[model samples]
Target: MMTLYGRRGWGSVLIEAQLAYYDLPFRFEEVDDLFTSASARKALARINPLAQVPTLLLDDGRVLTESAAITLHLADLTGRDDLVPGADAPERAAFLRWLVFLVTNLYPTFTYADEPTRFVADATAAKAFRARVDDYAQSLWRMVEHAAAAPWFLGERRSALDLYIGVMTRWRPRRPWFLAEAPKLHAIAQAIDAEPAFAGTLARNFAE
Candidate 1:
């Protein structure tokens, strides 16, 4: 069985949701304290050099880190092109484009917003950086809103992108903001929130 080291409501939720979608048997190790606990950090470091959660210990013993990578791997393992467009599919390019945008452009902003002190030496500077990054992330989200596929990011069919965006939107500049600024993406997030296939997984991670 595969072991997934991650916390509730974090990026790892996407991977866990995927696993649930495929009804794959795996063990979940709650290492949500990786950033705050010494022992947890050390343990996570043994599996992920970056000391990040959402680290998957494969049955073969290889450790996989990074949320997007893990989600893609799960899709590949299940051969679920329905969830992740196959390599030859025309939608694959668009899928990658949006996935990369969220992982690269939006994910980093959340990192900085969550721990601004890591990037700046002074407290005031850190405060400013956090605010700036939040604004930037919001702007990027609006841009994506224009490109979204109404009830989903990849058009009529739902993909892993929907799951990811649903969880991510719950973070800073949350769903309420999206409801106001990015109506389309907001609808997409809500749709994912109500998706029956992922209902149990999502409720387990996000009780509210």
Candidate 2:
């Protein structure tokens, strides 16, 4: 069994959704109230020196950091390589491209919205940073809306890209401008949220 160190947000929800989708048995350790806890900080540092949640400790003691990496690793373990596109398939390149795009381009947008100060300590500079992030996020999401294949990132079968996109899309309500500009992404998020696995994960971690 694997041990998952997670908190109550998207990082945790994403891992939970992947695990549930694969029916993989794992122990969940919640690191709640993360913003003010030394213990949480220390535990995360010990497991993933970067002090990040959604770290996966495999039974053999290997630690995996980054949510997408952990999810892809698990998919490989469960022989669900198709979920990420088979290694030899041409679509594999496309899969990798979008996966990296999600992590590097789309993911950071939410971070900027959540904590603008991290990018710039000065209020003036922070506002500028937020504006750039907002514009960049919108541009990327428009591309996503236009490039999306049918109902999923890769045609009909949902891939890890879909999962990542789904979580990021759910963050749009906070940015209002996102959905207003990227209606296709909004529709995609709605469809992904309605999936049983995604719904179950949300119910377990975010139910009101």
Candidate 3:
């Protein structure tokens, strides 16, 4: 069995959807806000010093941190080329590009946008920063929308990228903005959102 430590509606949603789609047995441990919950703080420290969610505890007792790392690891562990293209595959470059685009650009911005005070002491500065970050994130999502290759980001086969981007579309700038500004990416997310395999998993994390 695999154990996942995460906060509801976070990046862990993608991992949960993946595990569900692949029929993997897993358990989830909800971590309270790392800054405020003493129990969440201590529990996360034991496995991940950063106190981040989406930490995967393997059956062998090894732990995996970082959402992208965990997603790639699962693909490799299952030897699913469709899920994770091989290095030699021509699409691999595109895959790496978009995946890195996601984690590097959007993830950090999302973090700071959500908790602007972490970066600056002045409340005014934090608010300004978050506003800027919000605009930047919307622009970045537009880039993703332009990159869409139809039916899915990478063409035919669904990869972890689709799962990830789909869930994230519901965050921050949100589905409403996507509907207006990123019609292409919005369609892809709608497709993934409609996947029956992920319905329960998504509801567990995102249903209001």
Instruction: Indicate which candidate wins on lDDT.
Output: 1
Model 3 residue 46 lDDT score: 86
Model 3 — TM-score against the truth? 0.94
For candidate 1, give the lDDT of residue 181: 92
TM-score of each: 0.95, 0.87, 0.94
User: Cα lDDT of all candidates, in order?
Assistant: 0.85, 0.75, 0.84
**Candidates in order: C-alpha RMSD to true structure:** 1.3, 2.2, 1.4
- lDDT for position 180 in model 2: 82
In candidate 3, what are the lDDT values of residues 1-208, reduced to their tens digit?
9998888898778787888777889998888887568788887898998877778999899999888888788888887777677878878889888988998899888777788887878999999999999999988988988898978899987777888878999898888888899988888899988888777888888878
Distance from true location, Cα of 115 in model 3, Å:
1.4
Better of 1 and 2 by TM-score: 1
Model 1 per-residue lDDT tens digits across residues 1-208: 9998888987788788888889998999998465468888887888788887678999999988887888788888987798889999878999999888898899988766887787797999999989999888988998888889856888877888888888888898988998989888888888988989988999999986
Q: For candidate 1, give the lDDT.
A: 0.85
Candidate closest to the true structure, highest TM-score: 1
Q: Which pairs in model 1 have colliding backbones?
A: none
Can you tell me which runs of candidate 2 are displaced by over 4 Å? 172-178
